[model samples]
Target: MGDEWRAGGFGLYIHWPFCEAKCPYCDFNSHVRDAIDEPRWRAAL
Candidate 1:
Protein backbone atom coordinates (compact mmCIF):
# COMPACT_ATOMS: atom_id res chain seq x y z
CA MET A 1 0.00 0.00 0.00
CA GLY A 2 2.86 2.43 0.80
CA ASP A 3 4.62 1.63 -2.50
CA GLU A 4 1.30 2.06 -4.37
CA TRP A 5 0.76 5.44 -2.74
CA ARG A 6 4.23 6.58 -3.85
CA ALA A 7 3.30 5.63 -7.42
CA GLY A 8 0.00 6.32 -9.18
CA GLY A 9 -2.58 4.98 -6.71
CA PHE A 10 -6.33 4.38 -7.03
CA GLY A 11 -8.87 7.18 -7.05
CA LEU A 12 -12.56 7.86 -6.37
CA TYR A 13 -14.17 10.06 -9.01
CA ILE A 14 -17.57 11.13 -7.68
CA HIS A 15 -19.53 13.08 -10.30
CA TRP A 16 -22.11 15.02 -8.33
CA PRO A 17 -24.40 15.95 -11.23
CA PHE A 18 -27.00 18.00 -9.49
CA CYS A 19 -27.32 21.68 -10.42
CA GLU A 20 -29.96 24.35 -9.86
CA ALA A 21 -30.06 24.82 -13.63
CA LYS A 22 -28.13 23.41 -16.56
CA CYS A 23 -25.95 25.40 -18.90
CA PRO A 24 -26.66 26.13 -22.59
CA TYR A 25 -23.51 24.34 -23.86
CA CYS A 26 -23.48 21.42 -21.42
CA ASP A 27 -21.50 18.48 -22.86
CA PHE A 28 -20.67 16.42 -19.77
CA ASN A 29 -21.97 13.25 -18.09
CA SER A 30 -24.22 15.04 -15.58
CA HIS A 31 -27.84 15.88 -14.81
CA VAL A 32 -30.07 18.58 -13.33
CA ARG A 33 -32.34 16.77 -10.93
CA ASP A 34 -35.20 18.66 -9.29
CA ALA A 35 -35.24 16.39 -6.23
CA ILE A 36 -32.70 13.74 -5.20
CA ASP A 37 -33.60 10.71 -3.07
CA GLU A 38 -30.99 11.04 -0.26
CA PRO A 39 -31.61 7.52 1.10
CA ARG A 40 -31.38 5.93 -2.35
CA TRP A 41 -28.19 7.84 -3.14
CA ARG A 42 -26.49 6.67 0.08
CA ALA A 43 -27.50 3.03 -0.57
CA ALA A 44 -25.78 3.13 -3.99
CA LEU A 45 -22.40 3.92 -2.41
Candidate 2:
Protein backbone atom coordinates (compact mmCIF):
# COMPACT_ATOMS: atom_id res chain seq x y z
CA MET A 1 0.00 0.00 0.00
CA GLY A 2 2.81 2.40 0.84
CA ASP A 3 4.56 1.76 -2.46
CA GLU A 4 1.30 2.13 -4.42
CA TRP A 5 0.32 5.44 -2.76
CA ARG A 6 1.88 8.82 -3.43
CA ALA A 7 4.65 9.89 -1.07
CA GLY A 8 2.90 13.00 0.28
CA GLY A 9 -0.61 11.58 0.22
CA PHE A 10 -1.43 9.78 3.42
CA GLY A 11 -4.04 9.84 6.17
CA LEU A 12 -3.66 9.62 9.92
CA TYR A 13 -6.42 9.02 12.42
CA ILE A 14 -6.43 9.87 16.11
CA HIS A 15 -9.14 9.14 18.65
CA TRP A 16 -9.51 11.54 21.56
CA PRO A 17 -11.70 10.51 24.48
CA PHE A 18 -11.54 13.46 26.85
CA CYS A 19 -13.01 16.92 26.70
CA GLU A 20 -13.32 19.39 29.54
CA ALA A 21 -16.31 21.24 28.17
CA LYS A 22 -19.50 20.04 26.53
CA CYS A 23 -21.29 21.74 23.64
CA PRO A 24 -25.07 21.73 23.30
CA TYR A 25 -25.09 20.90 19.59
CA CYS A 26 -22.49 18.10 19.81
CA ASP A 27 -23.43 14.41 19.74
CA PHE A 28 -19.94 13.28 20.91
CA ASN A 29 -19.06 12.12 24.38
CA SER A 30 -17.99 15.12 26.48
CA HIS A 31 -18.08 16.35 30.03
CA VAL A 32 -17.87 19.64 31.94
CA ARG A 33 -15.78 20.01 35.06
CA ASP A 34 -14.59 22.75 37.41
CA ALA A 35 -11.13 21.37 38.18
CA ILE A 36 -8.76 18.67 36.92
CA ASP A 37 -6.23 16.54 38.80
CA GLU A 38 -3.40 16.26 36.28
CA PRO A 39 -1.05 13.98 38.24
CA ARG A 40 -3.76 11.49 39.09
CA TRP A 41 -5.06 11.45 35.51
CA ARG A 42 -1.56 10.99 34.11
CA ALA A 43 -0.92 8.11 36.46
CA ALA A 44 -4.17 6.47 35.44
CA LEU A 45 -3.36 6.90 31.77
Candidate 3:
Protein backbone atom coordinates (compact mmCIF):
# COMPACT_ATOMS: atom_id res chain seq x y z
CA MET A 1 0.00 0.00 0.00
CA GLY A 2 2.85 2.38 -0.76
CA ASP A 3 1.55 3.63 -4.12
CA GLU A 4 2.22 7.35 -4.67
CA TRP A 5 -1.08 7.77 -6.55
CA ARG A 6 -3.05 6.48 -3.56
CA ALA A 7 -1.25 8.70 -1.02
CA GLY A 8 -3.95 11.38 -1.29
CA GLY A 9 -7.44 9.89 -1.78
CA PHE A 10 -8.95 13.03 -3.26
CA GLY A 11 -10.96 13.03 -6.50
CA LEU A 12 -13.36 15.31 -8.38
CA TYR A 13 -16.25 14.44 -10.68
CA ILE A 14 -18.23 16.94 -12.78
CA HIS A 15 -21.44 16.17 -14.66
CA TRP A 16 -22.43 18.48 -17.53
CA PRO A 17 -25.76 17.40 -19.00
CA PHE A 18 -25.31 19.56 -22.07
CA CYS A 19 -23.88 18.27 -25.33
CA GLU A 20 -23.33 20.02 -28.63
CA ALA A 21 -23.45 16.79 -30.63
CA LYS A 22 -26.35 14.41 -30.76
CA CYS A 23 -25.25 10.82 -30.16
CA PRO A 24 -27.43 8.05 -31.54
CA TYR A 25 -26.87 5.91 -28.46
CA CYS A 26 -27.86 8.71 -26.07
CA ASP A 27 -31.39 9.65 -24.96
CA PHE A 28 -33.20 12.87 -26.01
CA ASN A 29 -32.03 14.60 -22.85
CA SER A 30 -29.13 16.02 -24.88
CA HIS A 31 -29.61 18.16 -27.94
CA VAL A 32 -27.57 19.52 -30.85
CA ARG A 33 -29.19 22.66 -32.15
CA ASP A 34 -27.82 25.57 -34.11
CA ALA A 35 -29.18 28.06 -31.60
CA ILE A 36 -29.85 27.79 -27.88
CA ASP A 37 -31.91 30.31 -25.88
CA GLU A 38 -30.04 30.52 -22.63
CA PRO A 39 -32.38 33.08 -21.11
CA ARG A 40 -35.49 30.98 -21.81
CA TRP A 41 -33.89 27.78 -20.55
CA ARG A 42 -32.55 29.53 -17.47
CA ALA A 43 -35.96 30.95 -16.64
CA ALA A 44 -37.60 27.56 -17.14
CA LEU A 45 -35.10 25.95 -14.81
Q: What would the TM-scores of all predictions be?
A: 0.48, 0.38, 0.41
State candidate 1's TM-score. Answer: 0.48
Q: Model 2, which residues run further than 4 Å from truth?
A: 1-20
- What would the per-residue lDDT of candidate 2 be over residues 1-45, giving only the tens digit for each residue? 665457767776553445676767888665666666757877775
The candidate maximizing lDDT is: 1
Q: What does candidate 3's lDDT look like per residue over 1-45, in tens digits?
A: 356557776565554356788778986566567677878877776
Per-residue lDDT, model 1, residue 12, is 63
Q: Per-residue lDDT of 1-45 in model 1, one digit per residue for the tens?
A: 567756779566776676778888887767788898868887887
lDDT of candidate 2?
0.64
Indicate the worst ten consecutive residues by lDDT in candidate 2.
12-21
Clashing pairs in 2: none
For all candidates in order, the CA lDDT equals 0.76, 0.64, 0.66
Error at 25, model 3, angstroms: 1.8
- For residue 27, what is the lDDT in candidate 1? 75
The count of backbone overlaps in candidate 3 is 0
